[model samples]
Structures are given as C-alpha cells and as structure tokens.
Target: MDMINGYLEALPEEERTPDPLYRERLDVCETCSRLQNGLCAVCGCFVLYRAGKTSSECPCGLW
Candidate 1:
C-alpha cells in the first residue's frame, strides 16, 4: 500500500477540466468515426495534441 501511495503521489496533477474541444471531438468520432468539423482531422487520437507528441501543424481546428 505504501508503494501504491508513492506511485499515486508521483503522478502529475489531475486536470480539473476536460478539454472541451477534445471531448466534443471524441464524442463525434465515436459516433461519426471522423473528425468533427474536420477538427481532429489527421489525428489518430484526440489526446495526441494534449500529450505534446503530434508532429502535425496546429490541430486546434475546433477553436
């Protein structure tokens, strides 16, 4: 249990607000299987941008 506590403490702070645009796009993708309004286009996953690993240009299409 002590190890579990240490692991939890080591994790980054939890985000209070889910990315609105990403959530919306996720919903759209689940239902539409495509980027909503072409926002998440070329993004295989919605969290790619938030994770800072996507190599494409700005994907802030929704906003």
Candidate 2:
C-alpha cells in the first residue's frame, strides 16, 4: 500500500485523477470480477495505482 501511495504521490498534480473520479473508478473496481487482492487481474496492476493516474484506463474497459 505504501508503494502505491508513493507512486501516486510521484505523479504531477495535473496528471493525477480528480478525487471524485478516482473514487468513482475505485467503486467500479470494487464491483469488478477482475479485482483480486487489490489488483486488476486483466492487466496485472494494482487497482489503486492504476486508478490514481489520470491517463490510466481499466484493462477491461470499465473505466
């Protein structure tokens, strides 16, 4: 979790997703079957990390 937080903190403010959208993206991930141990099975990425970036997209195209 700390690693993911660090990655998020490293992103420029403009490149970070807005709080509301990030939360929304997380909410979507929460309901996805591809979510496993906080990671996205489709792309092998931490959902928290992936959702934090403004340019990131869900591998399953849910986001």
Candidate 3:
C-alpha cells in the first residue's frame, strides 16, 4: 500500500485521477471478480495505482 501511495504522490496533478473519480473507479474494481489481492487479474496491475491515474482503464470495461 505504501508503494502505491508513493507512486500516486509522484504523479503530476493533471496526470492523477480526481479523488471522486478515483474512488468511483475503485468502487467498481472492488466488486469485480478479476480483483485479487488488490490487483486486477486480467492486466496484473495494482488496482490502487491503476485507479489513481487518469489514463488508466479497467481491462474488463467496468469503469
């Protein structure tokens, strides 16, 4: 979790997803069957880090 936080903190403001949208994306991810150990099984990305970026998208098209 610390690593994910560090990566998020390092992103430029414009590159980061807005707080509300980030949370919303996370909410979607949380309910996904593809979620495993805080990661997206399809893409093998840390959900925290992927959802925190404006450019990131769910591999399953849920968000």
Q: Summing lDDT over every window of 10 consecutive residues in candidate 2, give the lowest-scoring window.
A: 33-42
Task: Give residue 11's error in model 1 in angstroms.
Answer: 17
RMSD of 3: 0.6
Local accuracy of candidate 1 as per-residue lDDT tens digits, 1-63: 354335434545452224464455445444543455433545654433332222223344532
**What's the ranking of the predictions by lDDT, best on top?**
3, 2, 1
Q: Which candidate has the highest TM-score of all?
A: 3
Per-residue lDDT value at 41 in model 1: 48
Backbone collision tally, model 3: 0
Tens-place lDDT digits, model 3, residues 1-63: 898999999999999999999999999998899899997999999999999999988888899
Provide the overall lDDT of each model, using Cα atoms, as 2-decimal numbers.
Answer: 0.41, 0.93, 0.93
Minimum summed lDDT over a 10-residue window in model 3 is located at 54-63
Candidate 3 residue runs with Cα over 4 Å from true position: none
TM-score of 1: 0.26
Given candidate 2, what's the lDDT at residue 33? 87
